[model samples]
Structures are given as structure tokens and as C-alpha cells.
Target: MSQVFIVTDSTADIPDELVAKYQIHVVPLRVVFDQETYLDGIELSPATFYEKLGKAKVLPTTSQPSPVEFMNVYSQILNDHPGSQIVSIHLSSGMSGTYQSALLGKSMLEDEQTAEITVIDSKSASYGYGLLALHAAQLAQAGKNAEEIEAAVLKLHEQRKLYFLVDTLEYLQKGGRIGKASAVLGTLLNIKPVLSIDNEGIIYAVEKIRGQKKAMERIIQMFEQDFAGQRINIAVGHTANPASAETFISLIETRFELGEVVYPNIGAVIGSHVGFGTIAIFVWPA
Candidate 1:
């Protein structure tokens, strides 16, 4: 059996320690703040990125990694591992071009070599996507074949759920995720929209609760309802909102028997749209 190499983009939000432990390779997206551009996790740490986010006059923009970057990573992995298979898992294609780039890169490889790489669009983001990659890595390390890893990941991907609450709609409006008119109206009405990523990889507003507290409660309720009878592995994601994340973790621990609850800082690419005080819950059947 060939060794399997795992690859993922930074938006998956897998912790650095875990990445090192699992021997996973991550290709970071680019974050542009005015004249300065930084690679997602390479040039910017989450704490530093959030600090600059607060003081920036203009909102930062994110760019996906080029196909050449993916090609280089994949080629190097194959060279090092000899006959190993590469599985590149990434954030939703609908949300970013990272997945597309990986696919394009894989297509560019020679016919015989192409079969060595498998790219998957997780159709999820943040820790939600991270959990999928982590699970894939675990299976690969356990000597599972590429096909086996793909089947396991797709199974979890279908059942995975993500619910997020943002502090304000300003960033969403700026990102063009929500219309300016809707942002204004939502802010005026104090409406906190609970958003979810659908199976198609698009983020959609699921419900609008009147207050933040209610929104938090609604997130838990929705999880209980949709995820009933399912043993879950939960991941809590936040953009500089430790307090809200803590509250979310506490609620989950109190109400559910969660597997491993991983807390990872939302990377710059995803954080740029959600802004601060964003708390997201990622749940997968255990």
C-alpha cells in the first residue's frame, strides 16, 4: 500500500500543532490589507491579523493560492513519499477559488501521475472543514487507501453542519456576501442572522433571531433538532471572540456528549467577511 499525504488550505483552521503532529501540508491563501499582502498563516498570525483588522481603514481582501503553488506542493510530496497518494482537501469552492486551483493543478499533472492526487471540496469552512481534513489525516495515517479516505471524508461532509453568528453585517456587506440594503436593515432591526453552509457549498441565511443571546440559543436548538441521535464531534470557531466561543463550548458540553471539541481561530480569509465577535459551531457525526 502506498503512503497517503494530506493537504489542506489555511481556511480549514486546523491548529498549527495538529498540522505538525499529523504531518499535514497546508497551502495558505493570501490576505491583502491596503498595500501590504501577507500569506494567510505564513506572514500573519491570527492575533496580529486581528490587531491590524481593528485599525485598518479599509477591509482586507483575500486571494486564493495559484495552481502553481498547489502543483509544487503536490510534486514535492510525491517526490518525498515515492509512490504515495496525495489527498488535497480544501474549503468550499463556492466560497473561494482554492479548491478550483487544486483541481486545475491536479489536471496539469501527467496522466500516470494525476492518479496519485485526489482533491476534494469540503463545501464547508473554518473548523468545519478542518475537522474533515483532520479525520482524513487520521485515516491516512492509519494506512487507509486514498479511496477509503475519500469515502470516509465524503460521508462526514454530507452530515457535517455549520452555524455561525456575526457581530455585525458591515463586513458581510463589504464582502458583498450581503447587500448593503440588507445589512442596513438587519442592523437597524438588531437582527442577528444565523447562517449555514448548504450542501452546495454556498452560505445561506437560515434564520434571523432578534438578539445575540437568542441567536446563540437558536444555534444550539438547531443543532439538537437536526443532529438528533447522532454522536457528534464538535468544533467551535471564532474571530477574536473568546467570550462568545466559551459560552458556545459551555452550552455544547452541558447539553451534548461531544467527541473532541477543537477550537481554532478563524483564518484571515474567512475572518475578513465575518469580522470580530463571530462564533461558529461545526458538528459532525462521531
Candidate 2:
């Protein structure tokens, strides 16, 4: 492996195969149900989490990894690589404390140890930043240094755009991430909400559509206006809704040229907040 190691949290929702192929290091978050807690994607799979969520009496809660947790992972990577660089990319700080925890984790290291770690707040979620981590690893494998890889990833982040089509408002409202979107709650059952993380990484509603089909179409339309026919790398993140995600990808292909495409299940930490049938589409110029 290259001397530069790319690290990201489970909230990235990167598929297991890609993580293994790229050897990306993932620091998992946690999902809690009553008295039980499980690592985001390690102890609990997205499929299993949704099943438990459906049968549970209370809504499950999610927690960020502690600073010690991050430190342990960092220390291990350094021990193994000896003088390697780590770029720990994480979930949006506006959405969770995970990003802050990572920063604190780096601070806990000695001055010499701290110089090798760079923690970045993705200011994006799921495969939005997951795509960046993947790209960073690809750059590392190409013999690019940490500084060059980080600069490329940051530029990619600025070019990226993502939208989440939530099937219901119940999860968002319950998870306390409703924010200004609370105004759209309690509407008719068919009113699907289109949500996106803003520049500051806060989840906000783009629009409330009358149906799922229309909502997805509006999402594509928004992307068209954003990219305007540039060749792009795209990803589709879903909470156990692959069929819908596939259909959405076909529609996207008709509009813009695609470079690489990734389809990953939205993990438990994020799934608990979006609930089932949530489809998120992320796009960045290739």
C-alpha cells in the first residue's frame, strides 16, 4: 500500500467491497436501541437495523465515536505504517459530533504524531464524501502525496451536489434533524420530501413533491441545472431501496455522462434518521 492512508467513518456508507479493494480504514459510529448498542456497519448490517427499527417500540438513537476511539484507530495505523499520513474524513459537523470527535482525537496525539494526521469535516454525507475518500485512496495508490490528495479531495467536495428523497417526515422529525423542514411536516402521505445538505453541512428541504416519481424527477432537474452537461462521477445511497436507486441511475445516465458509479446501502447511523425507502443521489464533475 502507499504511505498515505485514507480514513473515513461508517457514515460515509461506502460499500464493503470498495472498502476492501481500496483498503480504506473506516471508524464506525454506533446505533442504539433501548439498552443495546452496535457499531454502525460492523456489529449491525443495514438490512438488520431496518428490521429491528420496524419492530421497535421506541425510535433508535445514533452516537458519534469518542475521541479515544479515533485515537486508537490512528495509533494502530501509525504503528503499522510507521511515518505514514492519515486523512480522516468524517460526517458533516452540522449533522453530528463525529467530525469534532475526530479533531479532538488528533489533538490528543503528541506534537510529532499530530503532524501526520489531517482531519477533515466533509460538510457532506454518505457517498457525497465517501466518493472523496475513495478518490483520495485512488490518488494515494497513484503515488500522490498527502497534500496533493487532500487538495484534490477538497476541490471535489466543492463540485459535488447531493439530494436525499425521504419517504416520510416521521424519522427526520423524530431524529431532531428536521430543522427548518419542520414546516413541511404533517402534510399528505404522498408528499415526498427532497432534502440536501447545505454548504454548512446542515440538512434542509429542497422541496416537497406530490409523489415519489415527481420528487426524483425534480432531483434530476436540479442536477441538470447544477452541472449543465459536465461529465460526472455519481453515487446512489439508499435505505434498502436498490430498485428505486437503479431506476434513478438510469434516468441520470440519460441526462449526463457518467464516469464511475457507486451504489451503497445507507448505513444504520444515517438510516435510523432517514428511515426506509430513502434514496440519495450524489454527483460531482469527473
- Which number leads on lDDT? 2
At residue 21, give the lDDT of candidate 1. 90
Please, what are the lDDT tens digits per residue for candidate 2 over residues 1-286? 3498998999999999989999999999999999899999999999899999899999999999999999998988988988899988999998899999999998888888889998989988888899999999898888888898889999988888999888787898999877768888744868887888888888888888988888889999998899895998889988876898899999889988999888889999999888888899998887
Taking the tens digit of each residue's C-alpha lDDT, what string does model 1 give over 99-206? 999999888778877899999998878887898898899999999999999999998887878888887877877786553224334544778888877777777788
Off by over 4 Å in 1: 178-184
lDDT of 1: 0.85
lDDT of 2 at 41: 93
TM-score of 2: 0.96
Per-candidate Cα lDDT values, in order, are 0.85, 0.89
